[model samples]
Target: MARTLAEKVWDQHLVRKGEGQEPDLLYIDLHLVHEVTSPQAFDGLRLAGRPVRRPDLTLATEDHNVPTLDVLAPIADPVSRTQVETLRKNCAEFGVRLYPMNHAEQGIVHVVGPQLGLTQPGTTVVCGDSHTSTHGAFGAMAFGIGTSEVEHVLATQTLPLKRFKTMAINVTSKDGRLRPGVTSKDVVLAIIAQIGTGGGQGYVLEYRGNVIENLSMEARMTICNMSIEAGARAGMIAPDETTFAYLKGRDHAPQGAQWDEAVEAWRELRTDDEAVFDAEVDVDGDALTPFVTWGTNPGQGLPLGENVPDPEAIVDENERVAAENALAYMGLEAGQPLRSVKVDTVFVGSCTNGRIEDLRATAEVLNGRKVADGVRMLVVPGSMRVRFQAEEEGLDKVFTDAGAEWRSAGCSMCLGMNPDQLAPGERSASTSNRNFEGRQGKGGRTHLVSPLVAAATAVRGTLSSPEDLV
Candidate 1:
């Protein structure tokens, strides 16, 4: 039977199908966890006198609650400290591998997994973190689950899930070229804007078309990382030569002729040219620009040089109220030019855009420039592996020299589980996902932009595009 990559992976992991009553049971290949969500699950396991079914398949890390600054000390916030401490004790008690803070291997869950080659193609991966879809860049079926579901996976190494419809996003280039300055972030923002936030509901979006195939692994990750925000269970790109090459000889990737066999299987994990989809969306690569989220949700966004929408212009009163409130809280005047907005801080690191390529791009802009006065900019690598690679190429020095604070790899300010946070009423240009009120901290206003915009904003002290800086 013909199958999309998502279907192929899904079928391979099926353990059993209920008698026309519920969903199929899926054997999970990898289970990722973080400190913030695992404590309750661990306690549940203890209460039930259950042991983790496959400790080898499960791994945990302390990203959310770990302090980015002063990592050597016990965390100052008691609640944060407890979260981190509980994770440490649970991992030890459960025999699951853990990468604690300040450990060279520690960082964001999504960042650390791929860096360690733990994310392989044609597998089912689950995490307590929403960005688990980031692993779908490797052609895996990955998604986030809630705490109870996290416990279910830890106890059984499998999950019962209803089937999802399939969506194919075909992105083609008119002249066989990616429009200049049109990045992966722009591509996804355009996808969400076109489909609306709920477009991918009950579906797994598989990216197709020449543009998707041509994107680098890092770029592919940037696209899939936001699948959740688009209301997709997960998002994936087919595994091909690029996928195999990226995984070859990585620390956890398959090796020897096993590697060769893995490649063959991954190569087959693509949509049969004739396979059907529940729906399809097409995007012209030439039409995209550096995107920025204008309101709270990822769906409320616009291109650079655009003006904020006036609430009165919004047709839906509900939407109008939301827009007005988002603008008011962000301290952005409605209908004002987005480019004219100033940023108090700029952060360039997260599972979304904190890879070596992201760092290199930010460093490119910062190479010969300095951060604008009073702009507290930070450059955090998504993983220890990224940190080493960046430092090897002197990208770290470039950022620090440009006045951005360089920190060890971790989730950092992406979700502010750590010491990296925004003060009340502080506005920041961030490369991470989610811009909800208090996402970074109380009264923290977030503008979701690309790494290019983040670096440029840091340099200019305002929301900007790289072209404007040039």
Candidate 2:
């Protein structure tokens, strides 16, 4: 029978098929843990007198609670310190491998997995993070699970889940290629805008078509990382030569004969040509430009060239209300040019756009430029290895020379769980995924943007794109 990519991966991981309404039991290929979500799960295991069934398949890291500026310093916040310490103790007791703070492998769990090549095609991955969808770029069936599910996976190495409906999001360009300034970030923001936040409810999105195919693995990750923002269970891309090449010599990737066999099997993980999806959506890549969110939710975005929309102009009552509230919270007025909105800070790091490629791109924009006066810019790497790589490539110099602070890896300001945070009422142009209320800090206002836009914003002190700089 023909099957879509999501269905193929789901079937391959099923250990016990559901009868009637019972959920199917699926074997997990990888289980990712972090300081923020693992403590309670570990306690549940202890209370149940259970040992982790497959520690080898599990990986833990200290990211959410680790400080980025002075990583070696003792954690200042007691709550954060407790979480990191508890994670260390639990991993030691459970015989699970953990990458603690200051360890070279330590990073956002999502970034660490792909960087080490532990994320692979046709695998089932679960993390206690919404952005676990980032691994889906490798063609894995990855999604975030709740605390109870995390404990279940730890105890049994399996999770019970109903099958997800599949959706194909075909991205094409009018001229056969994207415009020079359009990036995966812009493409995804545009998608969210078109579909709204609830459009992908109950479905796994498979990104297909020429524009998606031409994107690099890092760019693909940036796209898949934000699937949850559009209310999708997950997002994925088909594994091809680009996927194989990225995994070729990484730490956990198969080697030699195993590599050949692995690639052969992975190549077959694609959706059959005649397979059907439950729904289909098409996005025009040519029409996309740099995109930025003006509201708390990701769906409230427009092209950088557009102006703030008037709530009265919206025909839908609910939409009009949302727009009105968003404008009030954002301190924006209807019909105001987006480019004129000034910011107090510019942040260029997050699991969504904190990879080496992202850093390089941000540096390219800031090479001979300086951040605008009164605008503080932070250039944080996603992981320590990414930080090392950036330093090796002199990207760090470019960032520092542009008056941006270069810092070690961790989630940093992405979630504002650690020392990095925005002051009350502070406005920022950030490359992070979500811009929800207090997502960066208490009462902080966020405008989600791409790395290119982030760097340019740092230079111009507004919600401006790289094109605006020229």
Candidate 3:
């Protein structure tokens, strides 16, 4: 039978098929855990006297509550310290591999997995965090699981899940490529804006066509990382030469003859030409510009040159209510130019946009420029390896010279579990995913943008694009 790429991968890992309303049991190839969500699951195992069924496939990292400034010092917050220590204790007892804070390999689970060649095509991957969809960039069947499911997978190496319908997001341009300065982040923000936040509910999104094919692996990951925000079960791209090239030499990737065999198998991991999707959406990549979110949700966005939307003008009743709430929380006035909204902070890091390429892009824009007076800018790499690469290329110096704080990596201000966060009523132009109220800190406002836009906003002290500074 002709199959979609997702269907092909799903069938490959199917340990048991569903009958009637029963969920199918799918084997998990990679299980990633973090401090915030795993402690309870570990305790569940201990209470039941259940051992981790496949410790070799499980990995743990400390990121959600770790500080970015001090690597060697003990965590100052009692709650944060306990979380990290508990993870250490659990991993030690369970025999699962862990990359603790200050370890050379330590970083965000999503970022570290791909960097270490642990995320590969045609594999089933899961994590407790929602952004685990980030691994789908490699054509893996990756999605987030809950704590109970975490225990289930740890105990059985399998998850009971309902099969998802597929949605094809076909992005193309009249010229067959995105315009320069319109990045993958812009493309994704534009998608959410077009479809609204719940458009992909109960669906697995397949990003395809010319625009997707042209994007680099890092850029693809950035797009897939936000699929959860769009309410998709996961998002994926078909494995191709770009996917193969990115995984060829990583630490955990197959080597020698095994590598050749793996590549041969991965080459077949694509949708059949005639396979159909439940729904389809098309985006004009050329028409997209650098985008920024004006309201709370990722969908509440517009091109950089647009104005804050008027809530009363919204046609949908629910949308109008959401717009009103967003405007009230954001301190934005109707019809105010988004570019005129001043910012108190500029953050350039997260699993969504904290790779070496993201840092390099921000550095290129900040190259001889200074951050606006009084606007604090924080540049946290996604992982220790990314930090080392950035420093080796001197990208760190460019950011520090521009007055941004170059700090060690963890999931810093993206969700504000640690010290890197905004003060009350503070507004920021950030490169991370999501801009919900208090996502960065209590009473904080977030404007999500691309790295280029983030650097430009840091200089201009407003939501901006590189053209604004140029």
lDDT of each: 0.88, 0.93, 0.95
Residue runs of model 2 more than 4 Å from their true location after superposition: 174-176
Clash count in backbone of candidate 2: 0
Q: For each candidate, what TM-score against the reference?
A: 0.98, 0.99, 0.99
lDDT of 3 by residue, 341-411 (tens): 99999999999999999999999999999999999999999999999999999999999899999999899
Model 2 poorest 10 in a row by lDDT: 174-183
Candidate 1 lDDT score at position 245: 86
CA deviation > 4 Å runs, candidate 1? none
The deviation in Å at residue 424 for candidate 2 is 1.2
Residue 22 in candidate 2, Cα distance off native in Å = 0.4
- Expressed as tens digits, the lDDT of each residue in 284-311 for candidate 2 is 8878889999998999999998999889
Per residue, candidate 1 scores C-alpha lDDT tens digits across 172-199 of 8966557766689888987887887888
Task: Return the lDDT, model 2, position 309.
Answer: 89
Candidate No. with top lDDT: 3
